[model samples]
Target: MASRARHGGQAIDGRDLKGKAVISGLGLTEMGRIYGHSGGWFAAEAIRLAIDDAGLEKTDIDGLLVNQGMTPLPGMGGVDLQNQLGLTNLRLLSSMNVGGATAGIMVQYAALAVSHGMANHVLCVFADAPLREGRGGGAAYGGGGQQPQPRGMRGLYTAFGMFGVNARYAMAASRHMGMYGTTNDHFGAIAVAQRGWAAMNPLAQQREAMTLEDYHASRWVAEPLHLFDCCLVSNGGVAVIVSSAEGARDRKQPPVYIWGMGQGHPGDLNRAGWDIETQTGAPLSKERAFSMAGIEIDDIDVCQLYDCYTYTVLVTLEDYGFCAKGEGGPFVADGKLGPGGSLPTNTGGGQLSGYYMWGMTPLAEGVIQARGQGGDRQASKHDVVLVSGNGGILDHHCTLVLSPHPA
Candidate 1:
């Protein structure tokens, strides 16, 4: 789909950091509904697995970065990870939050650190314990809504903020429909296609094949956003090991090179004419990242765009120039993102069908695909992979261009 306006895969002259670093190891704990542990436990265990996967011991890691997600609890997978893992003398250590974008940003930070001599090996991790034993997935995200009721007419200004993310995304999706004649079917196409991808994934939570009828029959979470529009809640962790390209050579696992990285932060969502419904931070992040990768949109063989909701995939495709604006509805409805499609996107089912680890959901799948380890769902073309993360109410965005070959 992006082949229409494609550029040759040539490195553009700029501050290039292509192939400077690589992800040497990846560790994922059992995901989805396997309760009885804290987020900290998951993070620590993932780090251990990642270190072992890289053929390195705990002492080899000198940097630690954590993404605890938005509104994290008192001990949500960070703050105590280093001490719990018994990792000490860390040259780089920090806890950051860009909402769902944190996982990508953490890798960027780790890559920079390892390349610049701040640290030799860096660990990036994200985890969550949102699923309680007795409660449903909705309970983790406020089944009744996260805000308190308004008492007076003066409280009307807080109307939009009173609900949780379901309402917020519904507004964004509704705006697309009003402006571009988009339909529920367009969003349903995304859900159905990703579910199809999930059916081939062993770690996927919802592997059952779904059809257009099933998507339409699902209950509505908010207006046009259906039950399948939202991501799944999981109790697990994902960790990655970032090392210099030279350091990654001959590692235990195939090295997944970090060819390019970029981050974009929209100043204010309420600004006049802010493109909240029509655009996203992907466009702003794309140029810097692609140039560093020495490639264009056509060179990308696979994509792992964040899919906290079905609308997220549609808008991100439009913003990343994969398809024309307002045509995202039709672009997906044509069945272009599923298996055997022109563009193999979200090959691991994404957050929709994959276990939700915030940005790590897409990032982990990118690593797997780049290493040619996706097994049954692996894309035929594996030269270049595109990964993106969107945070806030589309306020922050980050992109990483990864490849099995060096840049």
Candidate 2:
């Protein structure tokens, strides 16, 4: 039970923090390999958009949290960003990264800050532009895939067993397949389904129609992991504004209350009792998040799970109690994650077909779904939304229970 003793930190840590803070605004930019413009530009533009979305001026922002990605924008997390935004005398300022899990963690910390009166409105933003001219995704990430042979220290490290994300996640998919009879078809189903949702999103990078056949036809990124099975390598930014529930209620956009949140860290892959293929931190995180939100699994209307890969989605679904340990393949292959399915997941195409802003991909879509602004990708029931973020080969996890109705 010590693992499940979740607490929202800050000055006021005794009372339940559910419904104490809300995400009042979201800002996004054209993502996925957009040329030019550094991450700082995208971040600044996103913050401005978020401020305007919340009907707040630049000076109204008292706090800022920046989530750094593979390619950190200059002056992103320090006073330089503050100066760029013309925000003076900030009460909160910090830069953080827990790989992809930072988005939900950022919101959780922001909620605590505002709920404890540390800052009235906190801005959380993440942006990355890794692709250089003529280089493919592999070059951006540094691997043998689709790029020239590694050079210098990178080649030495690669020789020393340092691998890219594709290899690591591909190994996870292979392990799951070996243990649970999960197959390429199951992963393909996720890819095709999210692609269907992407067709409806204006900001989605890959909105083309896709079929199961298309998924199978895609080239392999790491066997068992196709190009489609992996998430898109994107260049973009996403920003969210967290405000006190009282302050959010009067904002321009509808408030998506932060009912409950929890985080889990299972430690390094070498750690005992930690298995990347069969287990993750989701078990403990889900217990605390659902308990804090005062809701059961069935109460969830939609899921915005971090989709770093299709396999990641399937494994996470099983860990979050959506299906039994080994049944995620069939659970997702049933066409349930696509639009109009019983369980709509990754409605904005997710990172598979949509732009990848790390955890902000799910967090942004969760906010949109909670606000009923998902357009054709919006689910019918948006009362309760579950958002999940996975970091560092699923070693770190963050779960957030959000809803349109205050708890």
Candidate 3:
């Protein structure tokens, strides 16, 4: 198997792992508030489900990748999980903390490992117990009540009362509104559309339909962002099984081939002074992934983008070339993201209305859509999907182009 080359017209290194890997199985816990469950417990259960879904036994999992985020349960890292799961043939173990981009990065590593024969089957899992820590369940700011203080320059940001992820996103939204004439109504359209999708999702956290009026009436979390614009912080676990293309051929379910994968970190707002409002690392990552996949943006049939906030989704749509920059507001205004629209985005409702499994939710939903397992919310075209992950305050990004067959 040859390595997939990098995008951006770069020289082929003959070491990039692109289409050689495929996602054979995906599993998730009952999303939303699951009381009295540790992150480790949820992770273990999700791993079991993924393995079974892949038509394999526990022994088949030789690699494990764990993403416990900033506040992991007591014992949920890679080594701890390897011990907890009682796996005897574990050959690869690692942990990731790229914020929401962790899941996509894990898949990149899994593809590399499986393609190189380092591991036959790799399990990527993520879980968090913000509710178990006596924190405000599903709240985004202050680590859901952990109130973790920032370090270094972020400490300066904290002292000036610029704390919390939502605050930063709010600032970005305000800038976009000022620069491009984006309005609260434009942002509201995203909330309404995602909630509409959530209504059809059985495992979504907030399933009640939301209207533009509801979005305007909702309390403001920040100046430009309302309660509906933010994501739901729920307790749950999501896991995916990655294997070599050859290994996936014998799986019980259809394989969603990893056509392309890439990661980019242009800059971090707190430390790098990057422009958060108008720019993101998504374009860089998208270019690389699409280049390796040998497909243009128009080839995408569905998109499962990381929507930690509504603005995030809008900006990403532009950055990924789905629409021109500054046109995202209008592009998503007319129910384009809802069912029977030009583009069906976040079909499982995404983080805004779906369970916020950090980045895992989008990845799982992408696999489900490509496998044609999305029952009610399934898109009309399911051959190709684009799944993206954003981490930190729009600091890091990872993109994956997946398809039912190798492109």
Candidate 4:
């Protein structure tokens, strides 16, 4: 039998680390398509901004964690960032690639480091510049490397023209519709609602007001997935500072306490004997996070769900227990995810309508909401926030619960 903690079972409650660490600072670069900037430049800029925001200097940072999305080029990993920033003293240094789940897992590691006295102040940074005009852009999936295909898998996928991440997610959405009576309009509602939130964020790339009609008229990238349903590819970086709860209390901003965290990885979708349409790793991750936090889903006043696609958000809503299984379509059809809705989600517009920094955008938004800094899109009750990250074709899942007060 599998170990209890392996499947996010009840064995690991995370009580020992609850409220031991907090996010003291959050910083982001101007998010948009930049023609002449490298990923390291953006990462450095974000790190400096975060250190300044935390009211600390580089000398105070003894730990670093870097998440570089889909770019395996040399001198872009954690050690490269340390050298770029010229930090001499370091205790913990690491790099992570969990697809979109990188940022959430970064925080989990940061908390562990601080709680264990392995590091004093940890800087978690993420940067990506995948889209460049004219020249063929770098690969956006699988870290710019080719994966080994099984005997017949390549031929089968090629026959159906099912290449890349979009087609795989499209298949998942199609299966969801067949089983749950979900409609394209249901997915459209998510795009429209997040775009509405994006319209309020000055840093958002797609801030233009989009109506349901506009969403329906948008070009289809794949069956049941429109242009607006997809995430925007832009150049940006984000940095967050994690410190002990006692140290965070003296920082410049209100501390966003780390209450609980959990991670799970369902088998890869590319492999055989995996059902991409009916199953995701989110439920197990959610169970462990909520169990560790000693709170239920209703306690979350705000949510920053990874929005790589509109269907990603809908399936997460169902998997995270915000609504009944297979009832995500009807649950979000009433503008419940928009501003002033009963469940305010993706207040920063998410990757779909906001800038896409992979999972970092959602983590930054969660900290802002917990600190009560979300200007117009702030949730009415910003006490507890639920943040989720999805990697690959729903293969990896990470969940975090943030609160304004310690547990």
What TM-score fits each model?
0.93, 0.92, 0.92, 0.92
The lDDT for every candidate, in the order shown, is 0.85, 0.87, 0.85, 0.85
Q: Can you write out model 4's per-residue Cα lDDT over 60-113, one digit (the tens) per residue?
A: 999998898654424644787788779999998888889899999999999889
lDDT tens digits, residue span 34-111, model 1: 878888778888888889989988888989888874325244345477777778778988887898999999999999
Determine which window of 10 residues in candidate 2 has minimal summed lDDT. Answer: 6-15
Question: In candidate 2, what are the lDDT values of residues 320-371, reduced to their tens digit?
Answer: 8888999999999989999889999999999999889999999999999999
Clashes of each: 0, 0, 1, 0
Residue 30, model 4: Cα distance from true site in angstroms: 0.5
Error of 3 at 361 (Å): 0.8
Which parts of model 4 are misplaced by more than 4 Å?
1-11, 134-152, 268-274
Give a tens-digit lDDT track for model 3, residues 28-125.
89877788888888898899889888898898899988999544645534777888789878888888889999999999999989999999999999
lDDT score, residue 60, model 2?
A: 78
